[model samples]
Target chain A: MSDRQLADWRNHALNLESEVNKVVVGQQTPIRLITTSIFARGHVLLEGDVGVGKTTLLRAFTRGIGGGYQRIEGTIDLMPNDLVYHTYLGEDGKPHVSAGPLLMSGENLSVFFFNEINRARPQVHSLLLRVMAERSLSAFNSEHYFPHMIVFADRNQVEKEETFEIPSAARDRFMMEIPIVVPNDDAIMEALVFDTKFHNVDALVNTVQPDVLQFDQLNAFSNVIQSSVEASDTLKKYALNLWKATKAPLDYGVKVSGVDMNRLVLSGASPRGMSMMLRAARVNAWLNERTAVLPEDIHAVFHSTVAHRLVFSPVYEMRRTEIAREMLQGIVNAVAAP
Target chain B: MKTMIRIFYLLLGLNVAPQTAFAIDSQNLPDVPPGIVTIRTIDPVKLVGYTVGDIIEREVILTIKAPYKLIETSLPITGYEKRYKGQVIGIELKSVSHTKKENKDSATFDIKLAYQIFTNNVVAKNAALGPEYLNLINTKDSKDLVKYRIPNLDIAISPIAIFGQVKIENNMSPLRGPLLLSNVKENKWLKVSIGFLALSLLGLLYILGQRAWLPRMGGTFAKTHRKLRKLPQSPEGLKLGVAAVHESLNTTASMSVFSNNLGIFLAQKPNFSPMATELQQFFSLSRQVYFEPNAAHGLGTNPQQWLQSFVRRCRDCERGLTPETSTQKSGS
Candidate 1:
């Protein structure tokens, strides 16, 4: 694409963000990250409390993209085949088979939201991982492709009982794991509590303009964005150092209080994880209207892209959210950029 | 002969009165041969109020017949302590001098004596100059000799102060010691010490000063400017130069500072706040050089020169000085 065309698309992307911003109050960062993930052709994992507007934020984004939307509720008994097809009784009392939510959308699927994903069984997670990783599924003697689909899943970190934790390999397939929280702004909190406009979720989600971005062209524009945003040797080295720091934080002088540096990281971000990080950073640069990726671009997506991929020692896994935050901050602080 | 000797002594006293004002009467000379030592006179002037370190002068004169000449060896010597009743007193003869005049009938001798008081007394006491015995030998017969005795002169020797209350204003005398001591060398050393202290303080100020006028306080940005100046205009050189500046900003802020947090760095170090726009441009230039090397340089014909000037402005800000060209915009 020409520079002018790229600039126009960048404006459209920013417009999508503002459209979502209209509905979701005080979540500019997560909205921007989700927008970047859409442009990068990667899936996102949204984690927050039960009612911080996680689902609303994704719905608002899905409304803006506008191709096909599918929603699923993760339950304890949800099985792998439930995402593909289900059997129902016909009106004449005979059995009938119907394609499930995942296969019903087919190739037109643009946004797939799995709410409270941790509530699902590990077997369901294993099947969802294949769909997220390859954007395709093998079921019912056919291959199904969601070439335009971008999964946005949310799970509250408040509950532990009867919850099947997503394995590291499944988590690594996600490009970012962004956290949504209650807006600390007193005015926003008051609005959320008392404003009649915010009291209705469906009405609030309808406020965001639909079809602000072309879902069909997103994959192609992502390729253009990744190619146009140049990463010089110095930036590449900086990214490489960031990768090494995630692996061996002690070598980079990264220290987390009361955590042993030597045993903190059981495994670091994989090669695919690093590549996805670069992909997201390039999209961030494109969103910011830059022709080259700077260290700040990497920093904008560093924790979200790499933090989830880090497999911690089981001893420290209970405090993963807090420790991972401090560890990533330490890595960026300890490593210098050119 | 004794009466004639007495009359001659009176005549000699009359002659000595015109030559010396301190002449005193010499009477009742004992054990003196008649007509041999006919005339003699002694003067003890101002005999009262003598204290330690005070000098007393006595003048003596004698006329002896021609056959008997006064023996010079019998005169008192300097540093001779006087004795009273076989005990040595503190009074010592500090100096003595004599002159002789020869005449047809007899030889006249004039003698002067100075005695210094070395005694310490709590109260005023009577002190005296002890008498001296002089012998005259006859020239016609070496064995013939005569003795003449000079009477003692009694005087009062006082202490440095009286036993009662002494008032300085009333007792102001010309004989008092000086009040102020000599301090010429001490004054010279004090001036030198003050000069050295002032110089040391100035040196300390220079080392710890926040201004660029001082050598050591040129600061982090100044050092970075120097590093940039030495680099070439090549692509690698520009990259290295930008890294050097990034390093300096990080060191100044004590953390990594990118374009986004430049405001926080400025807020923490407000001296650099004036160059905020320029610093932002520099970060843009840094991004271009490090991340978009193939991209055209935005900083005019000579990027290295522009970088040098930009770093100089940053150096000025580091020194708490407002750069003259701070208003000038970077081409980037």
Candidate 2:
């Protein structure tokens, strides 16, 4: 694609963000990040509380970017087979088989939201991890490819009982783990409480214009953006240092109070995580109408892209949400850019 | 002839007794019994240049036999001048005191006498502390009075100046006003001390003050600019320059400084806020040099020069000075 065509698509991507913003109030950053993920062709993991509008935000995004959509509620007894297909009783008193949400959407599936993902069994998570990692699955003695699909999963942090924690390997497969926080502004809070439009989530999500971005063309355009956005040698070194800091923050002088930095990380961001970070940063740069990737671009996606991939020691894992946030902040604060 | 000369010497000794001997006439007074009184005197060391008001001190240690005690009233009184040939002399007894030590068989007296010169002359002249006659009474025989004498002290006195016209040519300058001390050296030292104090104050201002008028006022960025100036325009030199700036900003912010959290850095150290735009440009230039070396710097033809200028402005900002806004450019 030419620069002009990319510029045109950049406008469209921004338009899609504005359309989602129209329904999802005070979530501009996450919306921008989601837009970047779409163009980067990476899956997202939305984390939030029980009623902080995580589903509403994703639904609004699906509305703007028209494609096959699928929703599934994770449950304790959910089996891997439940995602492929399900067996049901027909009126003829015979067993009837129908494709499940994963296979029902087929290759055109672009947004697959698994709500309360932690409530699902590990077996279901394993199957989903394979699909998320390879974008292909094997079932029914055949193979299925979901080249255009991007998974969006959200789990409430308020609950932990009977919920299986997503393991490190599964978490690493995701391109980003975005935190969905309710807007803290008093006016926005007041609007959320009393605004009539915000009361009906379905109507609010439906308010977004549909199909502002062509979902099928996003893959090709993602490649174009990744190729066109130039990253300087200096930026590469900086990004390399950022990656190294995640692994060995002690060497970079990254310190968090009341935590031993040496034993903080069992593992750093993986190579794939760093690549996805750069890919998303490039999209961010392109979205900002720049040709070269700046450190600011990396920062825009740093915590979202890299924080989840860090495996803290089991001692710190209980406070992963707080410590991971501090560790990432300390990394950026300690590692100098060019 | 030898016997005649001996007789003359004996007569002279009789006329003027030895220094510590009694020199009183015994015609009208009963003489002290032989071995009854003995005197030893200590006088002033300087014997010449006795001008008016010069004091001569003499101490007499007298030992007298038992039953013969010194009558205190017989001691010489202050303000008394001795007579020689019925003429009052230039020396006056200023003070007299005595302390006594008594034993079973004998008693000793320690006498201290002070005399003052009351006269001067046009020429040097001889002077004397005249003799003192002290009486001793026998306690057993009240009617018997014995006289003991303290010999005179001999010294020379000189005038302060000659009596007649003195020539200025005789190694003497005309009398001038009271002496005034020269302060040329002191004045020179005072000026030097003031100069050093001013220099010390200026040095303190340069080191500790927040002004940019002096070198090293903004030490971090100033040092960075110095390093950048020496760097070549080569790719490696550019990286080194950018690294120098990064280190400087890190030190200024007291943490690793990147373009993203620059606002926080500025808020922490408001001294660098004026060059916020230039600082942003520096990060962009740094990124291009170290991270995006292939892309054109887009900071005019010589990006190294641009970096030097940018760091210079940052130095200004670090010094709490307003950065020159005219040089602001988009680093992209």
Candidate 3:
């Protein structure tokens, strides 16, 4: 792709960012991550406290990227088939079979968001994982494919009781796990709390222009960006260093104040996860108006892409977020940038 | 013309028996010499208050009538140990001297002797100095060998007193001893400790100089970090921050850090691998602030903080503070 073409793509991404920001104020990180994930053609896991605009951010992206959007509220009683088919009584007291959200959207389902996904059963999670991994499902004696589908799942970390936390296998399928943190700036907080438009979620989401970005063109755009972006040999070495640090930070001379490097990470980020992260990084580079991928671009999407893929030792699992941040910082601090 | 005279000498022995009375035997030699010699001891023969290691000295003067020459062979010599009644007296003769002078009618002889006492013999502590016989050969008449005696110079040598007690106040009190002579070991330890202190001082100075704590000692990134720390919250300060990073990076990489060879530079110095992204963004921010004049780099919050942190990391890289950068120094 030409520089001008990349610029046009970047402009579209900026527009999508602005459109999403209209409803989700000061959530620029989530918006950029979600946009990059969409361009990378990978699923995302959204995690944040309640009322921090996870749903709103997802809705804004769904509306901004013109596609059929589907949302499923997870519950303990949710069954595996609930995502593909629903059977209920009709007015004539006879049973009726209809397509569920996953099947309903069919080929055009570009964005599928599962809210409070941990509330769902493990069976439901396994089914979602299949849909996420394959992007197609055989339901009602028919195979349905979602060629442009990108799933967004949210887990309520506040109340974890009676919740079936997403397993590591399912979690690793996600390209990024973007946390929707509440805006800490006074202006953003004031706008969120005092502004009438922010009080109404539906109206707030409506402020963004529908189909501000062409969702179908993202796959091609992602391919062009990945192929065109220059990752120098040194940058690859830098990435390898980062990879090694994650696997064996002790070998790289990484030191986190209280955590033992040898025991910090049980398993390093997967190679598939690394590639996905690189893909997202390229898109981020394109968004930054660069034809060549820079180190910042990689860092921009680094933690989101790789944090969930890393398995911590059981002892550090409870303090994963705190220790993981340190461990990642250690990696960042341990490797030299070009 | 000189008159002829004959002299006779008398010697007496001392007794230190349990009876506290002094006894002397009076002997009269008829016409032995109407010119008998009279010997007077300058130092008293009966001595007092002599400690165990004390030396006893005595000077005796003998006067003889005319026509007499003192015998030189009668002088006491070193190694002459005195004994009392077959028991060893503590005194060992150190030296003795004999001198004679002629006068109008008489010849006077002076004799001097000294002794050092070593051990404290309990039986001999109060004993008298023992007597020894000397043969005085005549100078004129070579065949004449007269037996002469020097009376013992008695002195009281008290055993070294033990009148006081050594009271120890604490466990750290010094132990009594035959004092040790250890100046050699003390000198060696002193040299070692001084050398250690000197090395420590030198190391501290090196660190201070390397850290640019000393005046005019500019190390790598020393100026950069200092300027960043003292940077004012102004546009000019921001420019300075940018320029500081640029200059330091160029110096660290030993070349320009354009986008093309950034990898090559970092590859050459893998120590900077961890800071790959931060350095990239630092260049971006520099470009934005200086070239494009964009006040904001979309760095989320606190652009000044971002600049400061970037500058600090840049400084850390320059100084090899980070582990990745530290490897560079260690490799060499």
Candidate 4:
């Protein structure tokens, strides 16, 4: 595509972002990152405390994309088959199989939201991993397709009981872990409660055109965006250094205040995580209408993109996030700019 | 954290020091002895008339051609009289010599001896205290003795004595040969050959494992083969096809307009999607066939006719939308 077409496509994406903004307020960072993840054709993991608008953000983003959206509440009893079909005795007193939310969306599914995903059992997580990785699912001995789908999962942080944490392999399948914090700004909070228009999510989401972009064309568009976005050596180096630092923080001069640097690292981000970081960064840069990546782009998405990928030493179990954040900052400071 | 770090270092240091010290101490020990030879022999000779506790004297002479010193010596005996028969009968070593170029040498030994014999259907005991001597002399002609013997050297003497109230026995037979030797040689080459055979078998197994026999036996090979068979023959074409499918599912323009727009987009973004060309073609065809109004006007129809024809085409397309076929086409 020409530069003008690229610009127009980016503008169109921004317009979709604005449409989502109408329904969900004060989550611009997450909203933008989510949009980037969508264009990258990658899954996302949302982590936050309770009542942080994660669901609302995901719902609004799905509406902005204008395709079939399916949401499944993750529970301890949720099974792999539940994502495919519900088996029960109907009013006719006969056992029947009906399509679940995942299949109900059919081939047109563009967005899949899994809420409180950690509450789901590992068997369910494994099934979700397959769908997210292959964009297809096996149900009743047949492959169910979702060519344009992007999986958005939210994990609850408050409770540990009966919750099965998603394994590293499954977490790596997601391109980013966007943290949805409660907006600290009193004005945004006040506007969220007092604004009657914001209260009606359905009405607000309906403002965008339905099926604005064809679901099938997304891959092509993503390709165009990816190929067009160039990353400078300096920014690429910064990202790589950050990834290395996650694995070996001491080498990058990252000092976790109360943790032993030598013993604090169990495993670093896997190769998959580094690749996902670059993918997400490229899309983020593309959305900014920049042909090339900047250090600022890496900085903007570094924490959410990389923090959860780090595996801390068991000794630092209680301070994982804090140590990870410190290590990331140290990496940014230590890596020399070009 | 500081305490933890200190403790971690302390544990590591402690764990490493003992092994290091042990290794150093082991290295300081002396090397093991090697190449010392040992020789042992058993000589069986008749003691025709000897009694228990008798003081018997004997001597043995050995010829020497070179100078050598005797370090140490031992004599082992078996087969005694009475209850001690087939056990240690006697042992006697008199003396050793260091000599140079000597043709003959001799030494004397003393021991107590006894014998039992039968005569006229009555058991009898015999005892003696005389001397039987051997003289070693260097000679060219000597029929009754070895060629190297020294004259007038009383090297061997046997003295026998008996003490007990017992009848004398005669004509007792002496024990025969089959005296066991103390030294036995080990066949190292045989052991080495067996080890080599075992090592060769292990090497063969390693080669087989490297060739993936183990994985094949575990069924991973068959699974991988099945996965590979699903892949598209032309990767580039398949990727393009997938990209085209993505585009078709996403776009809303008429068939001609969409194709034209896609063509324009492809021209501008030549390397777009990196998916196979067949996939691209399939995607473009699906988009054009499913979403757009057919351009029958160029051939002979209006927009309404185009719409109806498009609807019919869409129905046909829907019928063809099998997940199996799609997965097969994608080779996934």
By TM-score, how accurate is candidate 1?
0.70
Q: Write the per-residue lDDT of candidate 2 for residues B10-105, one digit (tens) a residue.
A: 988877777436443433577788888888889877777678888889899999887898887788889898777778768889998989899888
Higher-scoring candidate on DockQ, 2 or 4: 2
Listed for each candidate, the true contacts retained, as a fraction, are 0.68, 0.76, 0.00, 0.00
TM-score of 3: 0.55
At residue A19, give the lDDT of candidate 1: 87
Per-residue lDDT of model 1, residues A179-268, tens digit only: 999999999999888999887999989998889999999999999999989998888999999999899999988899999999999999
Shift in Å, residue A23, candidate 1: 0.5
**True-vs-predicted CA distance for residue A97, candidate 2, Å:** 2.6
Candidate 3 lDDT by residue in tens digits, A54-151: 99888888898888999999999999888888899999999999999998877889899999999999999988888888988987678888888899
Model 4 misplaced regions, further than 4 Å = B1-332
Report the lDDT of model 3 for residue B150: 55
Q: Model 1 residue B167 lDDT?
A: 66
RMSD of each: 14.1, 10.9, 18.0, 34.4
Question: Interface root-mean-square deviation for each candidate?
Answer: 1.5, 2.3, 9.2, 20.1
Clashes, model 4: 59
- By lDDT, highest first, what's the ranking? 2, 1, 3, 4
The predicted structure with the larger DockQ, 1 or 2, is: 1
- Tens-digit per-residue lDDT, A238-268, candidate 4: 5777777788878866787877889988888
For all candidates, state DockQ relative to the true structure.
Answer: 0.45, 0.39, 0.02, 0.00
Considering every candidate listed, which one attains the maximal DockQ? 1
